[model samples]
Target chain A: MKFSVVVFPGSNCDDDAFQAVRSGLGQPVSFVWHGSEDLENADAVILPGGFSYGDYLRTGAIARFSPVMSAVKRFAAGGGLVLGICNGFQILLETGLLPGAMLCNSNLRFICRPVHLRVENASLPFTRSTRVGQVLTIPIAHAEGNYFADERTLAELQRQGRIVFRYCALGGEVTPETNPNGSIDSIAGIANEEGNVIGMMPHPERASDARLGSTDGLYIFRSLLDWFEQMRNAECGVRSQAAVPHSALRTPHSK
Target chain B: MKAKVFVALKRTVLDPQGKTILAALRDLGYADVADVRQGKFFEIGLSDGLGAEQARQQIERIARDVLTNPVIEEFSYQVEP
Candidate 1:
C-alpha cells in the first residue's frame, strides 16, 4: 500500500515516517507537501510528528489550516485511513477529526523518552496486530502531550472502545506513575468512531526499526498493511475497478 | 481598528505553566499570591473597509474559530475604534 506522509513547513519527522514505511516496512511511500492539495492517490495518509508552524498559537492550531488539510479532511470523510503521530495527533484534534484536545504536560517540560503503552482496544485496523492489554514500548517526545477531553466525550470514547492505547507500566498496569505527560486517563492513542482515523502521542515511526532499539512500533504499520491486503482481496472478489477500498465500500468495519 | 483578544484555559483544565509561575512568585517572596492561570493574547488589525459591527462580528468569529480552542479554552475580545 502506498502511504503519503504530509510534510508541513516545520515538520521534522516527515523523513522518519518515509523511512519507516520505505526501508522499515518495505512499502512505497511519498511526502505530500502542506501547500499541495494532491495526495498522489495514496491508500493511506500519515501526519508525522514535528513542531509544525513552530507550534505557534497552539500545537496544531495553525497547521490545521494548511491547504493539504482540506484534502485530508475529505479523505477522512470518505473513510480513508489516516494516522497522526505526536504533533500530527494534535492537528487531528484541532481539526475535529478526532475528539478532544491536548495540553502542556503537568510538569511543564519537554519530555523525550521511551514510554510504555498498553493496547486498550486491539480490534481496530491500527492495532489489530497488538493484543488487548499488550504493552508497547514506544517513545514520545513533546511538551504538550497531555491529552484532554470533556466529560461526555471521554465517556463516549470509553464506551465505544475507541480508546486504542493508554500509557501504562511495563507490566501492563495503568497507574498514576505510569502516566507520562499527565494525559487524562493516560490516553496514549485513540481512534475516531469509524476506526479509520487514529491519532497518538507516541512516535511509532521512531521505534519501527531494531536499530532504533525497538521494533514494537512495526505492529501498527503491519496492521494497516494487513487490513489493506484484506480489503484488496475483498475488493477483487466484488469489483475489479475500485481504486481505493474505502470504509463504506467494505462489507463491515474493520473495528 | 484593532481587536484585542485574550484566551484562557478553562477552569476545569489544569494549567501547569500557571502553577509553575505561581510557585515561582511565592518562592520570590510574594507570599500573598494565591493563584495563577496562563493564557494567550492576540492583537489583530482590521481592514479599514469594515464597519464597526462588521469588525466586531469578524473579530468575534476569528477569536472563536481561530484564536481559541473551545475544548480547553475560553476567549474574550474587544475591538477599538
Candidate 2:
C-alpha cells in the first residue's frame, strides 16, 4: 500500500513520518506539499506534526484554510484513511474533520516526553490490532494537547467507544499527575464518527523503530497496511472500512 | 475611518499567563492585586458606513471561530469608532 504525508510550511515531522512508514510498513510513501492541489494516488494520508506558519493566528487556524486541506477533507469524506499527529491533530480539529477542540496545555508549557496511552477502542480500523486498555509508550510534543468537548459530545464519545486512546502511566492509572496535558478524561486520540479519520496527540512515528526506543507505533501503521491489503483483496477500491470486527488487528504485509 | 477591536477572555475563564503574572505580583508584595485576564486585540480598517452595531456582530464571528475558543473563553468585542 502507498501513503502520502502532508507537509505544510512549518511541518518539521513529515520526513520522520515518511521514514517511519517506510521502515515500519515497508511500503511506498511520498511527501505531499501543502500547496499541492491533489493528494496523488495514495491509499492513506497523514497530516504530520509541526507549528505551521509559525503557529500564526493560532495553531492550525491558517493551515485549516490552506489549499491542500480542502483535498484532505475530501479524502476523509470519501472514506480514505486519514491520520493527524500532534499539531496535525490541532489542524484536524480546526478543519472540523474531527469532533472537538484543543486548548493550550493545562500547565501552559510545551510538553515533550514519552507518555503512556491505552487503546480504548480497538474495533476501529486504526486500533484493530490492540485490546482495550492496551498501553503503548509514545512521545507527545505539543502546547495544545488539552482536548475539550461539551458534556453531551464527551458522553457520546464515551458511549460509542470512539474515544480511541487515553493517556496512561507506564504501569498505573492516569491520574491528574499522569495526565500531563490535562485533557478531559485523559483523551490522547480519538476517531471521527465514521472512524476512518483519526486525530491523536502522541507521535506514533517517533516510536515506530526499536532502535529509536519503542516499537509500539509499529502496530498502528501496520494496521493501516493490513487494512489496505484487506480492501485490495475484497473490493479492489481505495476506501477504508471503519468497523473491524476482530481483536488484535494483524495481517502480514501481503506484498 | 479605522476601527480597533479588542477581544478578551472573560474573567471566569482560566488564563495561565495572567495567573502566573498575578502570582508573581503577590510574591512581589503587591497585596491588593485583583484577578487578571488575557486577551487579543485587532486593528481592522472599516469603511465609513460600518458602525459599531454592524461591526459587533462580525467581530463576534471572528471571536467565536478564530480569535477565541468558546468552550473556555468568553469573547467580548468593543468597536472603537
Candidate 3:
C-alpha cells in the first residue's frame, strides 16, 4: 500500500518516517509538503514528528492551519488511516480529529528516552499484530506530551476502548514513575472512536529497526499492512459475489 | 479598534509553569502571596468600520477559537474603540 508522509516547514523527523516506511518496511511512500492541498493516491497518511511552525503560539496551534491539514482532515473523515507521532500527535489534537490537548510535561522539562508502552487495545489497526498487555519499548521526545482531557472525555475514551497504549513498567506494571510525561492515566497513545485515526506522543518510527536498539515498533507498521490486506480481501469478496448474474444462477450455469 | 485577549489555563488543569513561579515567589520571601497563576495576553488591532457589538463578538470568537484551546484553557477579551 502507498503511504504519504507530511512535511511541515519545521518538521525534522520527516526523513526518519520516510526511511522507516520506504526502506525498513519496503512500502511505497512519498512526501507531501504542508503547502500542498492534495494527498495524491496514498492509502494511508503519516504526520511525522517535528516542531512545526517552530512550535510558536503552541506546539501545533499554527501547524493545524497549514493548507495540507484541511486535506488531512478530509482524508480522516473519509475513514482513511491516519497516524500522528509526537508533534504530529499535537497537530491531530489541535485539528480536533482527536480529543484532549497536550500540556507541558508535568516536570516542566523536555523528556527524550525509551519508555515502555503497554498495548491496551490490540484490536485497532495500529496494534492488531500485538497482544493486549504486550509491552513495547518506544522512544518519546517532547516537552508538551502530557495529554489532558476532562473527566467526561476521559471516561468516554476508556469506555470505548480508544486508549490503545499506556505507559508502563518493563514488567507491565502501570505506575506514576513509568509515565514520562505525566499524562493523565499514563496514556501514551489513543485512537479515535472509529479507530481510523491514531495519535501518539512516542516515535514508533524511531524504533522500527533493530539497529536503532529495538524493533518492537515494527509491529505497528506490520499491523497496518495486515489490516490493509484484510480490508482488500473483504472488498474483493463482495465484488466477486456481485459480479455473478442472477439469471445465470437461476440456470445453474454460474460458477 | 483594539482588543486585549487574556488566556488562562482552566482551574482544574495543572499549570506546571505557574507552580514553578509560585514556588519561586515563596522562596524569595513573598510569604503573603497565597497563589499564582500564569496566563497569556494578546493585543490585537482590528480595522475600523465595525460597531461596538460586532467588535466585541469578533474579539470573543477569536479569543475562544484561535487564542485559546478550549480543552484545557479559558479565554476572555476586552475591546476598545
Candidate 4:
C-alpha cells in the first residue's frame, strides 16, 4: 500500500516518517505538501508530527483550517486510512476527526523519552498485529500531550473500545506514574469509532527501526498492511464470484 | 469597536500552570491566597462596518469558536463601543 506523509510548514517529523515507511519498512511512500489538496493516490495518509503554523492560536487549531485539511477530511469520510502522530494527533482533534483535546502536561514540562504503551485493543486495523495487553516501548515528545474528554465522551469511547493504547509500565500495568502526561485514564492513543482514523501522541515512526532501540512500533504499520491485504482479498473474492453465472455454480455435494 | 476576550481552562480540568503559580505564590509567603488560575486575554479591534450590537455578536462568536477550544476552555468577552 502506498503511504503519504503530510509535510506541514513546521512538520519536523515528516522526514522520519518517510524514511521509516520507505527505507525501514520498504513500503511505497511519498511526501505531500500541506498546501496540496490532493492525496496523490495514497492509500494511507500519515499526518507527521510538528508544530504546524508554529503552534499559534493553539496547537493544531490554525493547521486544521489549512487547505489540505479539507481534503484530508474528505479522504477520511471516504473511509481512507489516516494516522496522526503527536502534533498530528492534536490536528486531528482540532479537525473533529478524533474526540477530546490536549492539555498541558501535568508536570508542565516538555517530556521527551521512551515510554511503555499497552495495546488496549488488538482488533482494530492499527493494532490487530499486536497482542492485547502487550507493552511496547515508544518515545513520546510533547508538552501538551495530556488528553481529556467529557465524561459522556469518555464513557462512549470506553464502551465502543475506541481506545487503542494506554500508558503502562513494563509489566503492562497502567498506573499514574506511567502516565507521562495527565491524560485521563492514561490514554496514549485512540481511534475513531470506525477505526479507520487513529491519533496517538507517541511516535511510532521513531520506534519502527531496530537502530532506534526498539522495533515494536513496526507492528502497527505491519498491521495496517495486513488489514489492507485482507480487504483486497475479500473484494477480489466478491468480484470473482460475480463474474461467474449463478447457473454455472453447483453444490459441492452434487459435484 | 474594541473587544477583550478572556480564555481559561474549564473548572473541571486541571491547570498545571495555575497550580505551579499557586505553589510559587505560597512559597513567597502569600499564605492567605486560596487559589490561582491562569488564562489568556486577547484585545480585538474590529473595523467591520457593522453597528455596535452586530459587532458585539460577531465578537462573541469569534471568541467562543476561535479564541477558545470549547472542549477544554471557556471564554468570556467584553465589548467597548
Fraction of native contacts under 8 Å reproduced by each candidate:
0.94, 0.41, 0.82, 0.76
In model 1, the Cα lDDT at residue A196 comes to 99
lDDT tens digits, residues A1-255, model 4?
A: 778888888989988888877777666777777788988777789999989989988899988988889989999999999999999999999999999999999999999999999999999888889989999999999999999999999999999999999999999999998899999999999999889999999999999888999988898898987787777769777523232111221111210
Q: Order the numbered candidates by DockQ, best leading.
A: 1, 3, 4, 2
Candidate 3, residues A66-143: lDDT per residue as tens digits? Answer: 999999999999999999999999999999999999999999999999999999999988899999999999999999
lDDT of 4 by residue, B10-79 (tens): 9999989999999999999999998888999999998856688988889888987788899999988888
> Would you list the C-alpha lDDT of every candidate in the order shown?
0.91, 0.81, 0.89, 0.88
Candidate 1, lDDT over the whole model: 0.91
Weakest lDDT window of 10 consecutive positions for candidate 2 chain A: A246-255
Candidate 2: tens digits of C-alpha lDDT, residues B1-81: 455556664564456778888888999999999976666777766677887778777777876777765555665555666
Name the top lDDT candidate. Answer: 1
Candidate 3: misplaced stretches above 4 Å? A238-255
| Worst 10-residue lDDT window, candidate 4 chain A | A246-255
lDDT of 3 at B8: 93
Please give the lDDT score at residue B56 for candidate 3.
Answer: 91
Q: How is the predicted docking of candidate 2 categorized under the CAPRI scheme?
A: acceptable
Every model's DockQ: 0.92, 0.47, 0.79, 0.74
Off by over 4 Å in 1: A238-255
Binned by DockQ into CAPRI classes (incorrect, acceptable, medium, high), candidate 3 is medium
Error of 1 at A81 (Å): 0.4
TM-score of decoy 1: 0.94
Worst 10 residues of 2 chain B by lDDT: B5-14
Candidate number with the higher DockQ (2 or 4) = 4
Highest DockQ: give the candidate number.
1
